[model samples]
Target: MTKLKTVVAMAAASALFLAACGSGDSSGSGGSYKLSFVQGVTGDAFYITMGCAVQEEAKKEGATVDIQGPQKFDPTQQTPVLQSVVSSRPDAILIAPTDVSAMQRPIEQATKQNIKVVLVDTTLNDPSIAASAIASDNVGGGKAAFEAIKQLAPQGGKVLVVSVQPGISTTDARAKGFQDAVKADSKFTDLGVQYSQNEPQKAAQIVTAALQKDPDIVGIFAANLFSAEGSATGVRQANKQDQVKIVGFDAGPDQVKALQDGTVQALVAQQPGKIGQVGVQQAIKALKGEKTETKVQTGFTIVTKDNLDSPEGKAALYKSSC
Candidate 1:
């Protein structure tokens, strides 16, 4: 009888342990709701900060949020992660798609399964697949970037933009914004944009070539972090730090450091954490059959050396981890 009692007690304890483990899966106060946030790149500070905010915000709404992403910011790398997330059949998905066109089909699959999709940071080609698109105003960021360049190069000479691959919504908007902003003023000569394909070395090569071609180039706008890093390196290598005005996008640690050291004069910083927080909030709302906003345009912060340590500047910084 004592052996029987011991066996029964062990079985009960095992059951309790199993239940505890399953609690985190999908069981919440208002029933189970699972949210998955796919980052553009796992190691990227912007995406990490965004993922952290999404996880915390989802918890507040009694939902379990999972973070998934590729090691590299490539559409092919992201596709498998998206497919896996869909297979999990989460209540909602918040994703930063690598490419505008490549992500459309994967997002469509999620929508077909009734999974609420909230696009964060980046967007897809077809906006209809998403319940809501929450991101910084990339065009505005781009315009701000050029305005900084204008201030640096008051006389306005030849200016270049180092950008990532084409068809990536955020960078594309930024490039367009810069171009349009330049068009309004005839003083600044547009030297044309160079595609980096998210490769820093390639961006560096492009910048080096541009500098060699246009030694009189007055300003450079780097559309993303990698491009900015490469541009800074290129400018420093060419010994044109004083002559070239470098304006960068995304206040990642490297960019902030660049700003501090005068590698980049200014940064058009996106509110990635806010975007993530809002993305999860909107996803939860969609799951609850609430009216979610079709578009949520989070604004950007212009960070410079003067205000680098200020509260606002600190807010603009990105974290590598939650």
Candidate 2:
């Protein structure tokens, strides 16, 4: 063949090779994969950071990712959003389920469609639907939050736990951890775990009631961001800032501000970004027919006034943006 004709033939062959490689497939191809990340709630710093991390990691893997969630952390609201995600038929889904049992059917349905599922940050009742679950050691973090409270109020008095409503695995675990820790310590008397349903106002009401019942309440553990915010508000409202030691979960902006202003003594900060990163990583692996750890435990840090300005503490701070 002429030199010009040979060059054209080589160019055509190269185009065909690239096309074959770029063909989207679940069988270990490096081509783009469709992924969806369903947050338990939108506009929350933890979920925002998780979404950012998932997008960042998906970019590296050439996967297209969409992050969607309910306006609030309600399973009824989240189920429709999840159904929409499933209808899109993405190759994989990484989700933070609002309820363990409520979300089971939807997640199992996705699995039935042959979509790989990775539970991020929170889990469902039937984890068998998920290929992997990546989240902070919530139980350990809860125990740590109580430990901080103990350090603050060593002479143990009545303590209250403000938590998101029942059925949220993460907060439930944290509450349990706090209860177990309290049970192990005779110094602290448990006031009871109050459900806020992720509403700050409800949490504040509970805290105020607890304070009314036992004005000598020494400490409080807020199980998540909204609960922490409400607990702080309650403490401020009751004018018990100096009297009540408050340890909270998640270092969101409000929680960090509370820590700085002495409303909250310490915060159990979960590595939500790390959870998202691992969720995407596991999803990719599962899609590629590679083995993945069914349970991946991310970590947490305790942020306090002492370390709020430190490098490690700053790293634990949550970001509102991707």
Candidate 3:
């Protein structure tokens, strides 16, 4: 063949090679992978931070991600949003189900279309649809809260649990764990559990009602970020902040302030950012037909006054921005 002809043939082959390797393509060296993320609710900054984490990490993986959620923490509201997200038929769907069972059918339906489904920051009742799940060990965190409160209260007086709405696996698990832990100690009295729907104003109202029912409440535990803040608000509004000790689940700027001010004794901080990062990587692995764990526990840590300035807390706080 002539030299000119050989050069042309080589150029054609290079173009084909680039296309196959995704060198010039949009998806991860190949082309961009469109991801659909359905969060539980956008009320608290924690979930927003979770979405940010996924977006940031997806950028690193060269994957495109879209995060969506309901305006509130209501399962009924999220159900339609999840359906809409699935309709787009993206490469993968990551979700924090509003209700464990309510979201099962939709997620399972998405899975049928060969779309990868990852459960992050929470789990669903129907487990088969999930390729992998990344969430904190809420039960363990609840036990940790109980232990901390126990140390502060040699003889427990009254304890109230302020939490988000029901059916969400993460919130439910933490509330149950806190209940179990408090029950384990016969000295403690349960003042009952109330749902805040993960709204600050609603949580404050719930706390106010609980205090009205029982004036001797001494220890308060909130199951998630919004509820925790609400618990603090109620205590302050009721003028009971001086008598009660508060322990919050999940961390945020307000929760950190609550801790500093000695209002929130400690915070059971979930690794929300890590959950996002881990979920996206697992989704990538699943897309590549690699083995992924069915249950991936990103776990959590207990943050208190002692470690507020420590390297671990600072590192985690910086990463999660909580």
**For model 3, the run of ten residues with the poorest summed lDDT:** 1-10
* Reference-based TM-score of each model: 0.90, 0.92, 0.86
Clashing pairs in 2: 100-125
Q: How would you encode candidate 2's per-residue C-alpha lDDT over 1-322 as one tens digit per residue?
A: 0011000000000111010111137575646899999999998999998899999999998899999999999989999999999999898999999999999998898887888899998998878667788877878888888888888888888888999988889999999999999999999898888899899999999899889989999999999999999999999999999899988888889889888888988888888888899899888887876667778777788888887887888998999896
Instruction: Please give the lDDT score for candidate 1.
Output: 0.81
Indicate the residue-level lDDT of 93 in model 2.
Answer: 92
Q: Write the per-residue lDDT of candidate 1 for residues 1-322, one digit (tens) a residue.
A: 0000000000000111011111223333457588888889887778888888887888788778888899888989999999999899787889999999988898898888877788998998787667778878888788888888887788889999999888899999999999999989999888888999888888889989998998999999999999998999999889999999898888788888888888788888888888898888777666666567777888777788777777877888898777
In model 2, where is the ten-residue run with the lowest total lDDT?
A: 4-13
Off by over 4 Å in 3: 1-29, 318-322
Over 84-155, each residue of candidate 3 has an lDDT whose tens digit, in order, gives: 987887878889877788878877888877788889877787665677787877777777777767766656
**Model 1 TM-score relative to the real fold:** 0.90
Clashes of each: 0, 1, 6
Top candidate on TM-score is: 2
- lDDT for residue 32 in candidate 2, whole number 0-100: 85
